[model samples]
Target: MIYISDKAKQKVDALRAEGTLASDYFLRVSVVGGGCSGLSYKLDFDNETKPKDQVFEDKGIKVVTDLKSFLYLCNTTLEFSEGINGKGFYFNNPNAARTCACGDSFAV
Candidate 1:
């Protein structure tokens, strides 16, 4: 299962209230081929649930991923950072053997 960190939850809340995203919209996290690493993470707000989709929630934030992506994301945590260096969502993935410096790509 995937988890969401407190900081990420706050950012998601703020994003939901900003615009475009409605109550039904949820965080969609997926992994795709090609990056500095072998795989890259993709995140967005989505309202639709596809067949065999895996859904998980943490801190009132709902996250969805397709079955294929779920294999690479199990036991992962989604976090957000707002430090002087940078501000963005991060994937703390236990399944990843290697990850890019930006933390956006990984290889398992």
Candidate 2:
């Protein structure tokens, strides 16, 4: 199961209100190739639910990911930070053995 932090939910809602995301859309998280750590994380708003997609909900937010990506994201925590580091979404993935300095990529 993927956990969405309170701040992350608020940010997503704010983005929706600002017209950046549609109400029918859900947060899609995936692991793509090509990053410092070999695997990069990606986030997008999607309306289609593929047969292989795994859907989860937290705090009224629906999160979706393909089955292949789910292997690397199980039990991951999605968060948003606007503090000293900067403002952006980040993933705290326990399955990751190592992550890049930017925290956008990881290796298992």
Q: Tell me the TM-score of model 2.
A: 0.95
Query: After superposing candidate 2, which stretches have Cα over 4 Å from the reference?
Result: none
Q: Residues 17-95, candidate 1, lDDT per residue (tens digit)? A: 8975789999999999999998999998899999899999888989999999999999999989987986499899999
Each prediction's RMSD over C-alphas, in Å, is: 1.1, 1.0
Error of 1 at 37 (Å): 1.1
The numbered model that scores best in lDDT is 2
Looking at candidate 1, the ten consecutive residues that score lowest on lDDT are 82-91
Local distance difference test, per candidate?
0.91, 0.95
Q: How well is each residue in 27-92 modelled by candidate 2, as lDDT tens digits? A: 999999989999999999899999989999999999999999999999999999997877499999
